[model samples]
Target: MFDLEQYLDMFLDESKEHLENLNRNLLKLEEDHSIETVNEIFRIAHTLKGMSSTMGFEKIATLTHKMENVLDDIRAGKLKITTAIIDLLFEGLDILDEFVKNIEAEGKESDRSIDNIINNLCNLNDVETTDSEKDSSSQLQDDFQYVTSIAQKAKDQGINCYEINVKLEESCILKAARAFLVFKAVEQNGEIIYSNPSTEDIEDENFSDNFNIIALTKLKKEDFKEKILAISEIKDVTIKDFDKDSINLDQVKNLTVNTGNKIQQNNEQNIESKNDQSESKQRKGKTSKTVRVDIDRLDNLMNLVSELIIVKTRLEDIDTDLKGQNMNEAIEYLERITTSLHDAVTKVRMVPIERVFNRFPRMVRDLSKELNKEINLIMEGEETEVDRTVIDEIGDPLIHLLRNSIDHGIETPEVRKSLGKSEVGTTKLIAYPDGNNVVIEVCDDGSGLNIEKIKKKALEKNIITKEQAEIMDDKEAAKLIFAPGFSTADKISDISGRGVGLDVVKTKIEALGGTVEIESEKNKGSKFIIRLPLTLAIIQALLVTVEDEKYAIPLNNIKEITSISTDNIRIVEGKEIVLYRGKTLPLINLGNVLDVERKSENNSKEIIVVIVKKGDKDLGLIVDNLIGQQEIVIKSLGKYLSGLSFIAGATILGNGSVALIIDTNSLFQREWYS
Candidate 1:
């Protein structure tokens, strides 16, 4: 028996891709009423209909079929594209999306009522609803005519057309698989142009034990029957010649009269098919290739690369004299190979950020209407790529930022015009690769962050003291918006204003080994910049020692390294601080924070400090000694030890010892610094 479970993942993946295409193209259609866009949408709808039907998702199939009819009418110029029509189509797309989500979550479509959207679509196209049996019977005459046309074409090409009937045994378990096998067998002899219950119905096992096929082949009747009966489950096979002359002349005339446009469409399709064949032949040697491997498999491949790096490190630590010059050369070569392998695996795990950016245009459009504001959203650098793991976690943070921009940053049309700005406020989302990081900036040309308002809210929420707010500069005031439980809005709504948005964005981004910063002016605009590492698995880190405990600090976060004398360190507000490069820098002692036991008191006068920058703030971490830098693989501290104060993860050292990596962002939190 065939295992349906094996195909579920593939089906869901493809269905989601199709849905995304439909949504993207529909948005395009709304803006530009071009025939190409309409036809593309029609094609997508038809394909989704067939796929859902074959998968036995009757609601999706039925709904898409209705959508297809409306698109067909629009293509035929029977109905004009309008806002109402577009909205109705969008409503239908939403339903289809929900259905797909339900299938993915529950292994079946949702039981929600689709009658409203279905009826709305029917009313739009003036299509009458009918029972399945009635619908199938009504299409029999059209199906017969279609088969006759194919048969006539085959006869002209000097090929014989035959109607073949095959019946399966009553005990047939996987009817769909058996039918597919039969089709494959028949295709080897000739082409099966038509089927009795339609190919989709047969694949869905919606038919009885018996089914018919119209085949165009050069083989004789007995030979075709013999080939089909060779299958294991076949109970009987019958074959008969299909004669076009047997079709009634009156019926042909009526079909031509009623479906003249459809016939023209069929002719156009034939030309397209011939063109496609020519193109296929011209490009036969080259094939586009892609494969969808489960994420777990990619993670395993990354683990292997990490192990190879560890082995390389081990070889490098070996005594060179005992192993000789050959060992040195071998180690060098292994290091080069491991580096290249690591890069290759990392590339494999990287995906274009466009997957996360595609959904925002629709979101911005809906929000524009909801807020009764004329807003234009511009996006760039969609081709920037990040690790697959980052891609999966980055969407929500970006959404929060975008929503925050729309609700709190961009002003209304009248307000914008009064401020001498464009009536239609503009919001821009731009992404680009910067060195080892991908930087995403969300900017708006509307009213910027209200510094005073933010400070007021911070004080009201007890997020900051009045003394701190009074001394805060404009930049520091803007940063206050990211404080937990901070909001400047007078009332809360669905968009934001529950004091839960920016903090979440900040937390999530920092958790992904990224950083978020804000730049804003009172009447100008606001730009939120987010910087994320390309990959999380392996990174170059500066190894350090606090007392006897070893730790790793990500190289990307390090701005500079310097030493300060004990006399230069000062205390302010009961926290240690130092003047560096004419600016005050807060200092955190790593040994004290981690509670590492001191081996002995040091008589050293200088202290080694690693300066790490989070956003616009800088802090110095006091460490015992620097072990230089090394490429390290980050391994998660298991669930039991997760959320360990400032430890991000652990890495295996060359000596097989483990060193915990510092979470620099966490150390920069207000509690640690302020």
Candidate 2:
């Protein structure tokens, strides 16, 4: 039985991505109207329709199907490209986006008022038809049919189908790449009706190198064909006719793996050798094997494994200290192997940055038009990877950032041309791996962040004191632009300025362990760069002890740990503050924050003052003592701590105790209460 609710959520996520892509690409297609771009738009629509149909979202599927028809018509050149068609497409996208929002709130497909949108799309059918409307079946296949057509003509010149037997050596890396090359070479001479693992998995790069099947047409083999011997990874390729009886049933029967351990000694080697032996038992008809699980399910699995890994590490450490040297060595080896295994498993939970970046161009296109501005969006290094958690939250913040760019960052085309700049303003979305973090940039070649306007607005809104405004630098003043209800627009525009707190974006990003930074020069444009961690499940954490309780502090926030004397812990406005390197550091006692009782009152007890940085501000975390660091897997705090913003999460220690990991920002955000 299929779970409708879970399937609906999956459909909703997939639909949002598809819709974003459609909206973005539609705008790009309007400007260029090239055949290739139109075909891409058609394909995206086709995919959305198919996905919606499978999920039983009838309204969305029906609407998208009509949209696909129009796109197909355009692709076939039956309908001439026009600004009207693009406008209708944008209208469709807006309706779809609204429907998606309803689903997100209601947890199912929405009962959207899509009647007008559907009628408008239906109106496109009245256009005069062109002769380019050939049968839809006469389209391109993934394989180049033209090349195959040329090769098929040689069949009369002593060419025939040959079944090639491929045997792969063990311990081969780059299996998918090697297999792809072999397939291309074999496919040149013949057609591949079947592969052992199936073609989809091969395309997704999801196979190991051990077996291959090729049905070749150019088989005049007195000797074994081709340069299969030249490929470094492939062991051998033997070619023969596609005979059912010719398969090595023994080799097919035995598929085994060995981690190569000596402790198993005779028994392990016996099992290995026995698996290698093939008997005359009837086969199971060579059924393909693979499990199709959703990416979210994989994330849940990783979370479980990460917790178990922490416990495993803690156990090994204890076993080493208490159980002598030899037992420690064996446990240490197991720890090494499993830790690497866990790292590889965690990599599976990451999504490519391209998933988030590919949906922007069309958005920039329409907004520019509606606002009567010209903007070109350039994307770079989109192959960057981030945890699925980060990817899920990243889309909207970038959307608001781009909209702010279009409506406010870029000026009107006439204004731009007058300023000696290109009439077309350019917006860029770039993502690249920076150390252990992913940096996403949304930049535009329009008006930069207006500092004076922002400062004036801040003072007028009472966001900052007059003295503070006067003393603050242009860079510092720009930060106020993200404040709640901070907009430089003279009047609220439909595209960008809403009364809602733009600071919510900053808050949300900070909640994800990400920091958003902005840079601008007068009349040049503004760039918003968001730095986010690659993964949230695992991080190098600084372990500290406060009143006999262990706490995990993310290493990213920790500037350094130092011993602060009682003299250094000075009083500023009756609040305990530490003077470090000629600056007053606001200090929060850990025990007080968690409501735990302190053990000692002596000022000489030697405090581990951890200097933590949240943006430009700094705070000192005063702990009873510092514990050594270890790799611990983070676990969620569950529903009990639903509103506990200060506690990011908890992690399991080796001895099976849970340590609460502090959310540095939330902790810093609270000082007076602490």
Candidate 3:
């Protein structure tokens, strides 16, 4: 016996893919209601309905069935596309999304009723009543199986047998088309064992709107009725439990047929031959080229590669002692293999950022309608790929930033017109690779950040003093929006201004080992620039030592290394500063910050300083020794040592020793620097 649950995961995965396709195509249709878009939407919806019915998700199957009908009507030029209709479709999509979520969690359809949405969809096509009135008073014939052996096999396979009686609307003109649609709908849930008036007679409109179908399906009686009734112009659907045991094989075989049987049989054979040839051509035309791997499997592979690099480093250390040519060669070979393995793993984990960007256009559309603001979102470089881990964590922060732009950055059409700006505001999200970092910028052309308003809010919240506000430059004032619980909006609304400010976005982006910066000009617009590393698993780092402890600094942050005399250091406003390139730079003592004791009590004549850049600010880190540069694999310090502010992560060195990776961004937050 075949169990439907065995294929549940595959069904869910394919269903999700179809849902995503539906969302994308619907958005396209909303933009331009072309016939091509409508046809595509209808196809996706049809596929989803079939899959849902097969999986026993009656609500989803019914909802999609109704949607398919509406789309079919639109394609046939029976209905005009309108904003209200599009919104209703979007609402239907939202419910389907929820259904998928429920299926993911509980391994079955959600218990929530979608009757209201179904009614709306049906009403769009003037379908007054969607629910079928069960007329159990009239039952189906028990000995009516066309093929007794197939019916027995279907029963053995756990497929429930059903006989459906469908009635079409009185005003339905294309009777043949509606009957064909009915057959397709029934076939999606199960195989049709027999149809009254014969399949050919029904297709030829040999009967009225009423048709009877004996189907071998896994769907329950009520579920099957719902699936059929969901179709537009489907006046009423009646279903009865078909009993295979009660079917008499001898009686079914003895049933007589006339000359019509010869013609029907000949037609079916020709149709089957054509279908086989089409299927053969399709199979030969396409190639299976890709496979979906679990992300966890890739993460495990990355971990194994990291361990191998560590072992390879240890081997090199041992080879150095032997100094044998063969040993050196073997170690070098191992090094090459490990390097190649690392690169392969990194590429495997790389995913395009478009996965995160694809969900925004629809969001922006909804926001525009809600805010009464005409805004156009232009996205560029969506194909830029980054680490999957980075992609996963970056979505929410980007969503928050985009929402902030929609709510605060972009002005209303009326306001834009008043300012002599174009009535439609433009928001742009651009991404590109800059060295080892992927930079994403979200910009808007509207009334830019109001520095004075932000200052006033900060001052009222006591986030900054009045004196600070008076002396703050435009850039500095713009940063105040990131303060916790700060908002310039006069009244709180659902869109924003409920006390949670841009601080959340800042916190999340930084948590992903990235940084966010603000750039704004009054009445010109604002840009939020986010810089993130390509991958966090492996990186080239500059190793330095402070006393006996070794530390690694990201080479990307290091601008230059120089030896400066202690006497060159100067004190300005009670802060240690250095004059480099005719500019004063703050100097940080790495040893003191790490609380490491000095190796030599005797004062060294020259101090080695590393100039590092964080955004527009530069700081020179004072360390005891420079250990050159090396590629290292980052490892977490576990929960016990998790909160160390200055340490980003730990990495295994070439000699099997551990080195702490420095968090350069945190350096600026230290009290010594502030």
Q: What's the lDDT for residue 351 in model 3? A: 89
lDDT at 174, model 1: 83
- Lowest summed lDDT window (length 10), candidate 2: 254-263
TM-score for every candidate vs. truth? 0.83, 0.70, 0.76
- Identify the leading candidate in terms of TM-score: 1
Q: Looking at model 1, which ten-residue stretch has the lowest summed lDDT?
A: 251-260
* Cα error, candidate 1, residue 72 (Å): 3.0
Which pairs, if any, clash in model 3?
none
> 483-597 in candidate 2: lDDT tens per residue?
8888777776577552134587788899898888878899887878888888888888988988789999999888888888776667766688876888778888878888878
Question: TM-score rank, highest first?
Answer: 1, 3, 2
lDDT by residue (tens digit), candidate 1, 169-288: 999988887888898888766666656665656755888998877776777888888888888899999888886564453433222111224333433343225575467556764544
Which residue pairs in candidate 1 collide? none
Candidate 1 displacement at residue 27 in angstroms? 0.5
- Clashes per model (N, Cα, C within 3 A): 0, 2, 0
- CA error at residue 459 for candidate 2, angstroms: 2.6
